[model samples]
Target: MTLGFGEGRAFGYAGCNRYFSGYTLRGNRLDLGTPGSTKRYCEGEGGEVERAFLPLLAHPFILQREGEHMRLIASDGTRLEFEAAAMESRYP
Candidate 1:
């Protein structure tokens, strides 16, 4: 999975599909609006991950960052960790 933030929006490739949503961040609290994604069918692990991951966006999460590592902590204490990807010029 990959995530990027810019201009009040959060977008990423969510294992099986690309997703985007508006976001508001104040201090360590991050709130994501209803997300929108492409309708694509995927099987196996990607599909399973998508199912488990997307719903987490519905609730606010606490963001933690240390160097190149970042983590999103859900209200239920589920922690999603991510490492910074190399910046590419492909995205605008």
Candidate 2:
């Protein structure tokens, strides 16, 4: 999974589909609006992943960063971690 933030928006490839939402950050708390995604039906593991992952975005989460790693901790104590990816230029 990949997530990117820019211009008060959050967007990413959410396992089976691309998703986008408006976001607000206050200190370490991050809140995201309802996400919009392409209507694509995925099967098997992808489908299971999508179902489990998308709902996590609905609730606000605490953001933590350490070096190249970032973690999002939900109110229920569920944590999701991500590492920074190599930057790729959009124009080449």
Candidate 3:
């Protein structure tokens, strides 16, 4: 299953590692594509998490939005956790 977040809703991770994939609905499933990222890396705190973060987003995530958080879980047991920010978003 996929997710539908709607238009004008920009998505990114905790540390401003943003993505350019727009959200759309195809029937009951949401289609996500065109994921682009910046080559820069953060070397400080949560860096390992950051390192783990990007590579884990290899495929389009099946998403679900909660009251405040968006939970993204993959089939490989890799879970990407992003706190819901009023100005930011994340998915795996």
Candidate 4:
């Protein structure tokens, strides 16, 4: 799948949360700004956890790939891993 620039794009969830992040290859850092969370007040079991997690993404990240797994290692020793696979999308 084409991940595009992996930054400077608006990514959203169905719950209405949007994130704005940027990538800088020079310092090998992916930075996210003040990410605005969804305020529609749709509280679910995981709503509080999701809201808390989104704001914690303000730190920088370093992307590492191992096979199909893309790991976003943050500066604080936190790693967000995403598995890359062929999904049915417009590009496919």
Q: Each candidate: what lDDT? A: 0.85, 0.82, 0.51, 0.53
lDDT of 3 by residue, 12-72 (tens): 6434354555555444333445556555666765556556554555555556667866666
Off by over 4 Å in 2: 86-92
By lDDT, the better pick of 2 and 3 is: 2
Q: Residue-wise lDDT of candidate 1 within 1-92, one digit each (tens)?
A: 77788767888877898888889999999999878888799899999998888988889999999999999999999998989996322222
What lDDT is obtained when candidate 2 is compared to the true structure?
A: 0.82
The local distance difference test score of model 3 is 0.51
| All candidates: TM-score | 0.90, 0.89, 0.53, 0.60
What TM-score does structure 3 among the candidates reach? 0.53
User: In model 4, where do residues sit more than 4 Å from their true spots?
Assistant: 1-7, 14-16, 22-27, 85-92
Model 4, residue 32: distance off in Å is 1.7
Clashes of 1: 0
Judged by lDDT, which candidate is best?
1
**What's the residue-level lDDT of 39 in candidate 2?**
71
